[model samples]
Target chain A: MNQIDGKSARALLLILSTFTYLLFGAMVFDKLESEEDTRVRDEIERITDRLKNKYNFSERDMHLFEAIAIKSIPQQAGYQWQFAGAFYFATVVITTVGYGHSAPSTSAGKLFCMVFALFGIPMGLVMFQSIGERVNTFIAYSLHKFRDSLHQQGFTCLQEVTPTHLLMVSLSIGFMVIVSGTYMFHTIEKWSIFDAYYFCMITFSTIGFGDLVPLQQADALQAKPLYVFATIMFILVGLAVFSACVNLLVLGFMASNADEVTAANREPPSAIVLERFARNSLVESQLFNIQKHSTVGVLPGRPRRMYSIVPNSAGDVHLRRRSTRRSIQDTVCCGCFKPRPPRYRFSLTRRPTNISHLVDLELY
Target chain B: MNQIDGKSARALLLILSTFTYLLFGAMVFDKLESEEDTRVRDEIERITDRLKNKYNFSERDMHLFEAIAIKSIPQQAGYQWQFAGAFYFATVVITTVGYGHSAPSTSAGKLFCMVFALFGIPMGLVMFQSIGERVNTFIAYSLHKFRDSLHQQGFTCLQEVTPTHLLMVSLSIGFMVIVSGTYMFHTIEKWSIFDAYYFCMITFSTIGFGDLVPLQQADALQAKPLYVFATIMFILVGLAVFSACVNLLVLGFMASNADEVTAANREPPSAIVLERFARNSLVESQLFNIQKHSTVGVLPGRPRRMYSIVPNSAGDVHLRRRSTRRSIQDTVCCGCFKPRPPRYRFSLTRRPTNISHLVDLELY
Candidate 1:
């Protein structure tokens, strides 16, 4: 298939998959919640009718009272636009975990929110991703050091730290955050443990259904600064942990995708060419002892330069590039010639082994 | 600085910046919304007091009425977990919109929701990213073809399609979507134009404050199939468009970061080494006419090989790695050697100019 068509086809496939998933979700939700939804609707009707009969309020007055009551819930939390609540609201906006327990009612406030999100969301995304990548790297480094320590203590059974190890660690941390959050909210808000756990899941996943918002009862947003602070911290830390998990998942997904494509014959020419180039480069550098696996030929010319690819003690492949007039001591090692540590790191390209990208000449 | 320390410092800087931003947002929100919030709160108090006086209801009954009124709001929208509403809810969950118009009330429903979100959110993310990337690529391709056509007609004024052009086009498309959505909601839902616009912004950002959710009134989710379809499409397409814009922004940010790091002397050894390797490889292939800018040295050795890097007619640098055992026809162009077109394409490494990553031997 043509490269562009293939790209389009893959996108189409994903869209179809998502649509099917949505359909499945809708079917399941309808099954699970429909009976309950009907029951709640019937219950609400019964209560409203009973209230109307007891109060003997006019229908118009009842409608007005309902609107007033609905509007007053946020006010019950006390001064929602005040500093603490506003800060909480700001966190929700940037994180996109808006619970809607309180929203700006004025048009100007709404407009400011839109503008704020325009810049804040991107900033938030980049920041969270950066933090997440660093966290993953830290975990990997820690695991690497741990394995080294174990080996030093005569435990040679441990393998090198892999993406899976980092993933598991990050996920474990995420689980702990959820559990702790559940405990905190359950204790303070007097919600059932199961309900608190559900709240934690909803909040952390950023679904934030707002069905059971924290800091809304007993004027908690205003009266309990420490709890509010903890809630905010929970949100930020939870998101960062989740982001780390996502980064690993994305990298794993890419690797598997590459593997699948490699096993298939119907691959794009560009990819085939690149893969061949990568293989040839590896062979040329003599990065591995694979001479028996594939044949390598030397190009013949009068002023021919023979580049030796050798493995260092660390098992890293190093390519020695030497010009004809230069001495062997002056030979440059191509492998270690990185321009700078990446400023904007994406986890996918951070691993040293997964390098296949050509250097950006513009940057060089 | 040490690499690990540098990483930690950057993350710290980002956290601080975000904290400062939240502070600024809180101050501004306090200034803007406080007066209106106070006013609304007082008005609700006055109205509720008057109603209580007229109805002669007890405080307990008033509290009951308030709770009942809030519960009845969702009920008023009809059976929320019916097929159409359930589908809407599914979209909201995967997208992380969480409008909170209706949410799972039962424990089983809540448990299922969490599990569903765990798998669904990632799938939704991957699907949206795939579609967004393909859309951006298609736009770039279209612009490239348009420029080519114009040049063929003697319109040399048109330059090649650049990232800036792509960003502008994507932003414009996003603006158009928001405007159309605002117009649609304003007309159909009887929301003011500004409120509709605010709703669009909030929904697309996935903040979803839920204060002004569409399809909640008039039982539109169940009654108006076409409207429901349009609203769902608006959310999905709007998100995809924003994702495209974000992709470009991230790439631009990375390029700028690279440029900044290159201009500074305090760069990491790994990047410096890699950059040098990339430059040396380019020079070895003689891919550019940069001999005037730097010295070209020949190494003193037997069995010497000299590699020539030449620029192809398209101005793309092609490194011809020819083996002496074969004729020139067997020469390979290293520039075009991309291992199968990337399956999990991150816009960052998709462009040809930004290639610098080493090939993954495991994949090879």
Candidate 2:
């Protein structure tokens, strides 16, 4: 496609996709609202009728059921905003900080939560995978350059220069920073060390459990903007440090196998190759033994071939020769093996040559 | 290490790690409690003292703040649990069907919510990665066996069997199951379709948002066991289907090149060969051209080897060549690129014979 056409098509596709999502979302919302309103009205009417027929219920009991029913309304909404928020929430939950103040308690709510997470978690994964791909590529490039620099300095492996030692050093610095920051926040906010660290952990994780918010009233009144700015800066810096550590760890592993694979498209060979090799070795040994035992009974029509030479075996030479003849005609080598050339006179003569002689012959 | 000794060491290491985590967690909890208690007492004292001095506040407004503050205290106490639940809640929230009647609203609570999520997401990722690794290995093994069976029936590549097609088929079945299950739950619980779907989403996601709980008065009076059994079955089935989809999707992606690099490691070819090939390719490329009148020349044996390559427009070519060369060297050739030997070679001959009496000679 032409560039202009391609650009327009892409733009159109983006708009269309977004619109489709929004349209479906709206439909779901409408359905939810209509259905929920009907259910609520019916429920209220039934409760009212019961109250009229039976002895008057206490205000507390009435309030309890109302609270329960009131809690039920959100689940019926099925709005897109709620789903997006929930999707973000699940990523937080599995990590186990357990900021429990917010949760679905109703059966329907819990059930919906489980269902939404099942799909959303995987979708979140796909997003993370895409991000990881980019991050890995950047790291791989940096490591490659680092390796080249190390090689120029006469180092064989990056690890030999103690990359892990450097990593530990960096981590120590990071740990100190986190501790100091926590300590400062503790003093300023009048929080205990545990609370400060907890705040740090929660803030860093982005789970925001919110069980212990820093409510520095005096500081807030005096410098609200400054307080907010510091918090943001602390979070950003913390995230950067954390990301760096992760990158280093990843790079360390990659550096060990740096020469073999790129950050992208590295695949290990199948285990089947090793399995087949072992199986074939066993089968070949058995065949050799059988041939050795049966060789003396062979008829005169079939002449023994001189090609087969089974190494590390107890088989007779005559049997080996006969088996070689049969194998030459019947067997097909598989996986990393090719059939030997037909018994050519030239090859037979060349086979016994030493390594130096072969090199000399090739060069000449 | 001896096998038994190695196993014991591993067990010890695992226990140590767990202990360390618990100790760190307890320390954080202790700090949180002390800090929170101090802040609450101070706040309550300041508020009451203000009320004693200022115009009298109504009982309801006074009660509201007290309730809010009291409610906020439980949030801090259940900090870890709430954090976990919130994380679960987030999963449900983002997936839609919010079941929002339950949420973390306190400043401390919201702060924890944000902080917990950031770290928890990555932890969740690590968990998923471990699970994915096992699942991928199992699926690969199964696929290999399946292919072998098909090979006996003479099929290759499951030709025309696209991964996308398989994904669609799996998703179709999954969607149907979800829809039917939701519909059935709606009928049984006398809930609206939206609520049922919401429940399904929450349950699948494992969010347990807890807004619209299932309440069966008849079941409570009768077969409570049966009701519990049905709930368990629902969950198990949902999990099975979810896991099946995940496994299938992962396997399908794995059948292609994208899955290769992410697989476990194997040794690759030596680096020297790749470097040499890359150097050769760079010199031979068309972009290596340099004019005699230009500041830099492209002739061999230049002192500015590094400088010449610095502004090199052939950067992409260099990278591609390096990566490709590395991959090729690492992989076994398997005769994929074996050069064809010359079919014929002429021998120079001096002859006194007539043109009619020609001689032919072969040279190896």
- Which one wins on DockQ? 1
lDDT of 2 by residue, A82-193 (tens): 3222322333333222233334434444454454345444543333333333333333334445655887899866532123433454466557768977987898788877
In candidate 2, clashing pairs total 97
For candidate 1, chain B by itself scores a TM value of 0.72
Worst 10 residues of 1 chain B by lDDT: B291-300
Off by more than 4 A, model 2:
A1-58, A61-191, A199-364, B1-61, B64-160, B180-192, B199-336, B339-364
Candidate 1 lDDT by residue in tens digits, A138-186: 6665665677788789997764444446568889999999999999999
> Top model by lDDT, which number?
1
Cα misplacement distance, residue A80 of candidate 2 (Å): 17
